[model samples]
Target: MSADQKHFSPPARLLHWLMAPLVVAMLFIGVGMVATLSSWHQTLLAIHKPLGIAILGLVSVRFIVRLTHRTPPLPNDMPRWQQHIAHLSHWVFYALLFAMPLVGWSMLSAGGFPIHLFGPVNLPPIVPQDVQLYALLRSAHTVLALLLFATFLAHLGAALFHGLIRRDGVFSSMAKGRD
Candidate 1:
Protein backbone atom coordinates (compact mmCIF):
# COMPACT_ATOMS: atom_id res chain seq x y z
CA MET A 1 0.00 0.00 0.00
CA SER A 2 1.04 3.60 -0.58
CA ALA A 3 2.31 5.38 2.52
CA ASP A 4 -0.77 7.56 2.75
CA GLN A 5 -3.13 4.68 2.10
CA LYS A 6 -1.74 2.86 5.12
CA HIS A 7 -3.82 5.02 7.45
CA PHE A 8 -7.13 3.97 8.85
CA SER A 9 -10.36 5.36 7.43
CA PRO A 10 -11.66 8.61 8.94
CA PRO A 11 -14.62 6.86 10.54
CA ALA A 12 -12.34 4.26 12.12
CA ARG A 13 -10.07 6.94 13.54
CA LEU A 14 -13.02 8.85 14.93
CA LEU A 15 -14.44 5.78 16.64
CA HIS A 16 -11.07 4.86 18.12
CA TRP A 17 -10.54 8.29 19.66
CA LEU A 18 -14.11 8.52 20.89
CA MET A 19 -14.11 5.15 22.60
CA ALA A 20 -10.75 5.70 24.31
CA PRO A 21 -12.05 8.23 26.78
CA LEU A 22 -15.34 6.42 27.33
CA VAL A 23 -13.59 3.18 28.13
CA VAL A 24 -11.23 4.91 30.53
CA ALA A 25 -14.17 6.59 32.20
CA MET A 26 -15.98 3.28 32.52
CA LEU A 27 -12.99 1.75 34.28
CA PHE A 28 -12.82 4.59 36.76
CA ILE A 29 -16.56 4.42 37.29
CA GLY A 30 -16.30 0.75 38.03
CA VAL A 31 -13.60 1.38 40.59
CA GLY A 32 -15.68 4.07 42.19
CA MET A 33 -18.67 1.76 42.36
CA VAL A 34 -16.72 -0.84 44.26
CA ALA A 35 -14.68 1.45 46.51
CA THR A 36 -17.56 3.11 48.21
CA LEU A 37 -20.93 2.48 49.70
CA SER A 38 -21.61 6.16 50.08
CA SER A 39 -24.60 7.95 48.53
CA TRP A 40 -22.47 8.50 45.45
CA HIS A 41 -22.45 4.75 44.89
CA GLN A 42 -25.97 4.94 43.53
CA THR A 43 -25.03 7.81 41.26
CA LEU A 44 -22.13 5.76 39.97
CA LEU A 45 -24.42 2.83 39.33
CA ALA A 46 -26.85 5.02 37.38
CA ILE A 47 -24.02 6.25 35.21
CA HIS A 48 -22.30 2.88 34.88
CA LYS A 49 -25.30 0.92 33.67
CA PRO A 50 -26.19 3.22 30.83
CA LEU A 51 -22.58 3.86 29.93
CA GLY A 52 -21.92 0.12 29.67
CA ILE A 53 -24.90 -0.21 27.36
CA ALA A 54 -23.68 2.70 25.25
CA ILE A 55 -20.24 1.09 24.94
CA LEU A 56 -21.94 -2.14 23.94
CA GLY A 57 -23.83 -0.42 21.14
CA LEU A 58 -20.82 1.59 19.96
CA VAL A 59 -18.58 -1.50 19.95
CA SER A 60 -21.07 -3.36 17.78
CA VAL A 61 -20.74 -0.56 15.25
CA ARG A 62 -16.96 -0.40 15.72
CA PHE A 63 -16.61 -4.14 15.05
CA ILE A 64 -18.35 -3.67 11.74
CA VAL A 65 -16.08 -0.76 10.92
CA ARG A 66 -13.04 -2.86 11.72
CA LEU A 67 -14.19 -5.75 9.53
CA THR A 68 -15.08 -3.55 6.56
CA HIS A 69 -11.93 -1.40 6.60
CA ARG A 70 -8.28 -2.23 6.04
CA THR A 71 -5.97 -1.34 8.93
CA PRO A 72 -2.56 0.19 8.44
CA PRO A 73 0.17 -2.45 8.32
CA LEU A 74 2.94 -2.68 10.87
CA PRO A 75 6.42 -1.35 10.09
CA ASN A 76 8.25 -3.68 7.73
CA ASP A 77 11.36 -3.62 9.91
CA MET A 78 9.41 -4.74 12.97
CA PRO A 79 9.87 -8.33 14.07
CA ARG A 80 7.44 -11.00 12.90
CA TRP A 81 6.68 -11.97 16.49
CA GLN A 82 5.86 -8.37 17.36
CA GLN A 83 3.55 -8.18 14.39
CA HIS A 84 1.83 -11.34 15.55
CA ILE A 85 1.52 -9.92 19.04
CA ALA A 86 0.07 -6.71 17.66
CA HIS A 87 -2.52 -8.59 15.65
CA LEU A 88 -3.37 -10.78 18.64
CA SER A 89 -3.69 -7.75 20.88
CA HIS A 90 -6.26 -6.15 18.59
CA TRP A 91 -8.45 -9.22 18.57
CA VAL A 92 -8.16 -9.34 22.35
CA PHE A 93 -9.33 -5.75 22.47
CA TYR A 94 -12.37 -6.57 20.35
CA ALA A 95 -13.18 -9.57 22.48
CA LEU A 96 -12.92 -7.60 25.72
CA LEU A 97 -14.87 -4.70 24.32
CA PHE A 98 -17.78 -7.00 23.52
CA ALA A 99 -17.38 -9.12 26.61
CA MET A 100 -17.31 -6.40 29.29
CA PRO A 101 -20.78 -5.06 28.60
CA LEU A 102 -22.38 -8.39 27.89
CA VAL A 103 -20.95 -9.86 31.07
CA GLY A 104 -22.10 -6.81 33.04
CA TRP A 105 -25.55 -7.16 31.56
CA SER A 106 -25.69 -10.85 32.30
CA MET A 107 -24.40 -10.34 35.83
CA LEU A 108 -27.09 -7.79 36.53
CA SER A 109 -29.72 -10.01 35.01
CA ALA A 110 -28.69 -12.88 37.19
CA GLY A 111 -28.83 -10.58 40.19
CA GLY A 112 -32.33 -9.48 39.22
CA PHE A 113 -31.26 -5.91 38.68
CA PRO A 114 -32.75 -3.67 36.03
CA ILE A 115 -30.67 -2.62 33.02
CA HIS A 116 -31.89 0.95 32.97
CA LEU A 117 -30.56 3.24 30.26
CA PHE A 118 -32.63 6.29 31.09
CA GLY A 119 -36.18 7.24 31.86
CA PRO A 120 -38.49 4.18 31.75
CA VAL A 121 -36.48 2.18 29.27
CA ASN A 122 -35.14 -1.12 30.57
CA LEU A 123 -33.48 -4.06 28.90
CA PRO A 124 -35.03 -7.45 29.38
CA PRO A 125 -33.06 -10.04 31.30
CA ILE A 126 -30.81 -12.26 29.23
CA VAL A 127 -30.32 -14.85 31.93
CA PRO A 128 -32.72 -16.11 34.56
CA GLN A 129 -32.29 -14.82 38.09
CA ASP A 130 -30.23 -17.09 40.34
CA VAL A 131 -28.12 -16.09 43.27
CA GLN A 132 -25.40 -18.61 42.47
CA LEU A 133 -25.24 -17.52 38.84
CA TYR A 134 -25.14 -13.89 39.90
CA ALA A 135 -22.20 -14.60 42.20
CA LEU A 136 -20.29 -16.44 39.50
CA LEU A 137 -20.95 -13.80 36.84
CA ARG A 138 -20.11 -10.97 39.22
CA SER A 139 -16.73 -12.56 39.94
CA ALA A 140 -16.16 -13.09 36.25
CA HIS A 141 -17.01 -9.47 35.52
CA THR A 142 -14.46 -8.20 38.03
CA VAL A 143 -11.73 -10.43 36.63
CA LEU A 144 -12.51 -9.47 33.05
CA ALA A 145 -12.54 -5.81 33.97
CA LEU A 146 -9.11 -6.12 35.54
CA LEU A 147 -7.90 -7.81 32.37
CA LEU A 148 -9.40 -5.03 30.29
CA PHE A 149 -7.58 -2.38 32.29
CA ALA A 150 -4.27 -4.19 31.88
CA THR A 151 -4.88 -4.61 28.15
CA PHE A 152 -5.68 -0.94 27.78
CA LEU A 153 -2.45 0.04 29.49
CA ALA A 154 -0.48 -2.33 27.28
CA HIS A 155 -2.06 -0.74 24.21
CA LEU A 156 -1.16 2.74 25.36
CA GLY A 157 2.40 1.67 26.03
CA ALA A 158 2.64 0.05 22.61
CA ALA A 159 1.30 3.17 20.96
CA LEU A 160 3.90 5.29 22.71
CA PHE A 161 6.61 2.83 21.74
CA HIS A 162 5.62 3.17 18.10
CA GLY A 163 5.01 6.92 18.10
CA LEU A 164 7.90 8.10 20.24
CA ILE A 165 10.57 5.41 20.32
CA ARG A 166 10.33 3.60 17.00
CA ARG A 167 9.15 6.68 15.10
CA ASP A 168 6.80 4.30 13.37
CA GLY A 169 3.60 5.36 11.63
CA VAL A 170 1.43 2.85 13.45
CA PHE A 171 0.35 5.34 16.08
CA SER A 172 -0.19 8.19 13.65
CA SER A 173 -2.23 5.96 11.37
CA MET A 174 -4.88 6.05 14.08
CA ALA A 175 -3.97 9.30 15.84
CA LYS A 176 -3.63 11.61 12.81
CA GLY A 177 -4.89 9.41 9.98
CA ARG A 178 -1.44 9.34 8.33
CA ASP A 179 1.78 7.54 9.02
Candidate 2:
Protein backbone atom coordinates (compact mmCIF):
# COMPACT_ATOMS: atom_id res chain seq x y z
CA MET A 1 0.00 0.00 0.00
CA SER A 2 1.12 3.55 -0.68
CA ALA A 3 1.89 6.06 2.07
CA ASP A 4 -1.18 8.10 1.06
CA GLN A 5 -3.42 5.10 1.83
CA LYS A 6 -2.18 4.81 5.41
CA HIS A 7 -5.18 6.79 6.70
CA PHE A 8 -8.82 7.12 5.71
CA SER A 9 -9.95 10.02 3.60
CA PRO A 10 -11.36 13.06 5.40
CA PRO A 11 -14.97 12.22 4.48
CA ALA A 12 -14.56 8.62 5.61
CA ARG A 13 -13.11 9.76 8.93
CA LEU A 14 -15.88 12.33 9.30
CA LEU A 15 -18.60 9.74 8.72
CA HIS A 16 -17.00 7.17 11.02
CA TRP A 17 -16.72 9.61 13.94
CA LEU A 18 -20.11 11.13 13.21
CA MET A 19 -21.91 7.78 13.11
CA ALA A 20 -20.18 6.20 16.09
CA PRO A 21 -22.05 8.16 18.76
CA LEU A 22 -25.32 8.04 16.85
CA VAL A 23 -25.16 4.26 16.55
CA VAL A 24 -24.39 3.95 20.27
CA ALA A 25 -27.28 6.27 21.09
CA MET A 26 -29.58 4.24 18.85
CA LEU A 27 -28.71 1.05 20.68
CA PHE A 28 -29.46 2.62 24.06
CA ILE A 29 -32.60 4.32 22.79
CA GLY A 30 -33.78 0.96 21.45
CA VAL A 31 -33.27 -0.52 24.88
CA GLY A 32 -35.08 2.42 26.48
CA MET A 33 -38.00 2.01 24.09
CA VAL A 34 -38.31 -1.63 25.05
CA ALA A 35 -37.87 -1.15 28.80
CA THR A 36 -40.19 1.76 29.40
CA LEU A 37 -43.99 1.52 29.71
CA SER A 38 -44.73 5.20 30.30
CA SER A 39 -44.89 8.20 27.92
CA TRP A 40 -41.16 7.84 27.50
CA HIS A 41 -41.84 4.74 25.43
CA GLN A 42 -43.57 6.78 22.78
CA THR A 43 -40.90 9.45 22.95
CA LEU A 44 -38.16 6.91 22.52
CA LEU A 45 -40.02 5.31 19.64
CA ALA A 46 -40.28 8.72 18.05
CA ILE A 47 -36.53 9.16 18.18
CA HIS A 48 -35.73 5.57 17.25
CA LYS A 49 -37.46 5.40 13.88
CA PRO A 50 -35.94 8.51 12.43
CA LEU A 51 -32.55 7.67 13.84
CA GLY A 52 -32.67 4.24 12.27
CA ILE A 53 -33.51 5.75 8.91
CA ALA A 54 -30.72 8.30 9.31
CA ILE A 55 -28.27 5.51 10.05
CA LEU A 56 -29.47 3.61 7.00
CA GLY A 57 -28.92 6.67 4.84
CA LEU A 58 -25.52 7.46 6.26
CA VAL A 59 -24.29 3.88 6.06
CA SER A 60 -25.30 3.79 2.41
CA VAL A 61 -23.10 6.80 1.76
CA ARG A 62 -20.36 5.34 3.94
CA PHE A 63 -20.48 2.10 2.01
CA ILE A 64 -20.06 4.01 -1.22
CA VAL A 65 -17.13 5.84 0.26
CA ARG A 66 -15.63 2.55 1.41
CA LEU A 67 -15.96 1.08 -2.07
CA THR A 68 -14.26 4.01 -3.71
CA HIS A 69 -11.54 4.87 -1.19
CA ARG A 70 -8.38 2.95 -0.44
CA THR A 71 -8.46 1.62 3.12
CA PRO A 72 -5.30 1.51 5.22
CA PRO A 73 -3.65 -1.88 5.46
CA LEU A 74 -3.02 -3.80 8.65
CA PRO A 75 0.44 -3.46 10.15
CA ASN A 76 3.01 -5.83 8.63
CA ASP A 77 3.84 -7.32 12.02
CA MET A 78 0.19 -8.26 12.72
CA PRO A 79 -0.59 -11.96 12.56
CA ARG A 80 -2.40 -13.45 9.57
CA TRP A 81 -5.21 -14.65 11.85
CA GLN A 82 -5.55 -11.13 13.20
CA GLN A 83 -5.73 -9.75 9.67
CA HIS A 84 -8.44 -12.24 8.72
CA ILE A 85 -10.39 -11.43 11.85
CA ALA A 86 -10.10 -7.73 11.13
CA HIS A 87 -11.45 -8.19 7.63
CA LEU A 88 -14.24 -10.48 8.79
CA SER A 89 -15.26 -8.12 11.56
CA HIS A 90 -15.45 -5.20 9.13
CA TRP A 91 -17.82 -7.10 6.81
CA VAL A 92 -19.90 -8.00 9.84
CA PHE A 93 -20.06 -4.35 10.83
CA TYR A 94 -21.19 -3.41 7.34
CA ALA A 95 -23.82 -6.15 7.34
CA LEU A 96 -25.21 -5.11 10.70
CA LEU A 97 -25.15 -1.43 9.80
CA PHE A 98 -27.16 -2.04 6.65
CA ALA A 99 -29.39 -4.83 7.97
CA MET A 100 -30.50 -3.38 11.30
CA PRO A 101 -32.38 -0.40 9.91
CA LEU A 102 -33.78 -2.30 6.99
CA VAL A 103 -35.05 -4.97 9.34
CA GLY A 104 -36.58 -2.39 11.66
CA TRP A 105 -38.21 -0.63 8.74
CA SER A 106 -39.51 -3.93 7.39
CA MET A 107 -40.77 -4.90 10.83
CA LEU A 108 -42.74 -1.69 11.10
CA SER A 109 -43.99 -2.15 7.56
CA ALA A 110 -45.20 -5.62 8.34
CA GLY A 111 -46.95 -4.27 11.42
CA GLY A 112 -48.74 -1.74 9.23
CA PHE A 113 -47.29 1.24 11.08
CA PRO A 114 -46.45 4.43 9.22
CA ILE A 115 -42.85 5.53 9.78
CA HIS A 116 -43.17 9.11 10.90
CA LEU A 117 -39.81 10.75 10.28
CA PHE A 118 -40.80 14.06 11.90
CA GLY A 119 -44.02 16.00 11.92
CA PRO A 120 -46.04 15.29 8.77
CA VAL A 121 -43.24 13.40 7.03
CA ASN A 122 -43.81 9.66 6.77
CA LEU A 123 -42.21 6.75 4.94
CA PRO A 124 -44.35 4.39 2.89
CA PRO A 125 -44.61 0.78 3.79
CA ILE A 126 -42.02 -1.55 2.32
CA VAL A 127 -43.93 -4.74 2.97
CA PRO A 128 -47.48 -5.92 3.03
CA GLN A 129 -49.09 -6.00 6.48
CA ASP A 130 -49.24 -9.49 7.99
CA VAL A 131 -49.22 -10.39 11.68
CA GLN A 132 -47.04 -13.43 11.10
CA LEU A 133 -44.60 -11.43 9.02
CA TYR A 134 -44.50 -8.73 11.69
CA ALA A 135 -43.69 -11.33 14.33
CA LEU A 136 -40.92 -12.81 12.19
CA LEU A 137 -39.44 -9.44 11.38
CA ARG A 138 -39.60 -8.32 15.04
CA SER A 139 -37.80 -11.45 16.14
CA ALA A 140 -35.18 -11.02 13.44
CA HIS A 141 -34.67 -7.39 14.43
CA THR A 142 -34.14 -8.30 18.09
CA VAL A 143 -31.74 -11.13 17.33
CA LEU A 144 -29.75 -9.11 14.84
CA ALA A 145 -29.64 -6.24 17.30
CA LEU A 146 -28.04 -8.48 19.91
CA LEU A 147 -25.51 -9.64 17.34
CA LEU A 148 -24.81 -6.04 16.35
CA PHE A 149 -24.15 -5.14 19.98
CA ALA A 150 -21.79 -8.06 20.43
CA THR A 151 -19.90 -7.23 17.26
CA PHE A 152 -19.72 -3.60 18.34
CA LEU A 153 -18.13 -4.61 21.63
CA ALA A 154 -15.62 -6.79 19.81
CA HIS A 155 -14.80 -3.92 17.47
CA LEU A 156 -14.34 -1.60 20.44
CA GLY A 157 -11.99 -4.06 22.15
CA ALA A 158 -9.91 -4.45 19.01
CA ALA A 159 -9.71 -0.68 18.57
CA LEU A 160 -8.60 -0.26 22.17
CA PHE A 161 -6.08 -3.05 21.76
CA HIS A 162 -4.55 -1.33 18.75
CA GLY A 163 -4.76 2.18 20.19
CA LEU A 164 -3.53 1.53 23.73
CA ILE A 165 -2.00 -1.91 24.19
CA ARG A 166 -0.27 -2.28 20.84
CA ARG A 167 0.30 1.43 20.35
CA ASP A 168 -0.09 0.77 16.63
CA GLY A 169 -1.20 3.27 14.03
CA VAL A 170 -4.21 1.14 13.04
CA PHE A 171 -6.51 2.92 15.47
CA SER A 172 -5.15 6.32 14.55
CA SER A 173 -5.81 5.58 10.88
CA MET A 174 -9.50 5.93 11.64
CA ALA A 175 -9.49 7.91 14.88
CA LYS A 176 -7.03 10.70 14.04
CA GLY A 177 -7.21 10.45 10.24
CA ARG A 178 -4.40 11.61 7.95
CA ASP A 179 -1.94 14.05 9.46
TM-score, per-candidate, Cα-based: 0.97, 0.97
Query: Candidate 1: where is the Cα deviation over 4 Å?
Result: none
Compared with the true structure, what per-residue lDDT tens digits does model 1 show for residues 140-174? 99999999999999999999999999987888888
Root-mean-square deviation of Cα positions for candidate 1 versus the true structure, in angstroms: 1.1
Mark the 10 consecutive residues where model 2 has the least summed lDDT. Answer: 1-10
lDDT of each: 0.92, 0.93
- Supply candidate 1's per-residue lDDT for 161: 95
Q: Write the residue-wise lDDT of candidate 2 on 83-110 in tens digits.
A: 9999999899999999999999999999
Stretches of candidate 2 above 4 Å error?
none
State, as a TM-score between 0 and 1, how close model 2 is to the true structure: 0.97
